[model samples]
Target: MLEVENLDLHYGQSRILYEVSFQAPKGQITTLIGNNGVGKTSTLKAIAGRHPASAGTITVDGTLVRLTTAFQAANAGIAYVPQGREVFPMMTVEENLETGFACLPKTDHHIPDHIYDLFPVLRDMKARRGGDLSGGQQ
Candidate 1:
């Protein structure tokens, strides 16, 4: 469960968001749609702590977090896959996936089998260079 209320964000003196609010619960797909430069990505960046909110609050699992950094958000179970795939080109497929472990505890470092199920080709090409993969594959 997640909730964002009365969020405001800015870049220097340029304001990007104003009183933005939304909610998402487990087992549902909530989408944020808008025209270009309407603060969709800005709102997400605020929620994920990629961008700081000038005002307002974000609550996840009933805990209020004033997002100020990506590390804080990741520690609160907020995972963000940005619009552009920023996979490590030099790392193997397996190694790239292993990077996700940074957000998890040691007890959960292993890759989930279901992830492989979703991207079966990744399992087969685990040893290959990530840079060589097709854009779509990455």
Candidate 2:
């Protein structure tokens, strides 16, 4: 499970989130629904470590996680797919996936079959350049 407790965030002096909190259980899809400028994206940014939370605790599976950088969030098994689909244009789809191995030891670097199972098209387009795929594929 992923938990955000008493999350507070700010952009300069304007407060984006005030004591926001939520829990996302494992193996389930959780979504944030709200009108524009209601801090939905801000809250996601805080959880994804794209922005710092002024005060709060983020925990994954009962372990507290420090969200200081994108890499830190990845280390905590948090994955964030940007809305703009920011994939390396020159790299193949498989190559992009392999980039995540940067934070892992060499022995654990290979992509597992489960990943391909979850998104079979990725397996078929593994050799295709990221920029060549449609937005949904990316």
> Where does the lowest 10-residue lDDT sum fall in candidate 1?
65-74
Which residue runs of candidate 2 sit more than 4 Å off their true CA positions? 25-29
- TM-score of every model versus the real structure: 0.85, 0.79
| Candidate 1 accuracy as lDDT | 0.89
The candidate scoring highest on lDDT is 2
- Model 2 scores worst on lDDT over the 10 consecutive residues at 65-74
- Please identify model 1 stretches exceeding 4 Å from their true place: 68-71
Best by TM-score: 1
What TM-score would you give candidate 2 relative to the actual structure?
A: 0.79
What lDDT does model 2 reach? 0.90
User: Residue 13 error for model 1, in Å?
Assistant: 2.6
lDDT (Cα, tens digit) per residue for candidate 2, span 1-138: 999999999999999898998999988999989998999888888889899989989899999887778878888888887757899999999999998887688999899999999999999999999999998888
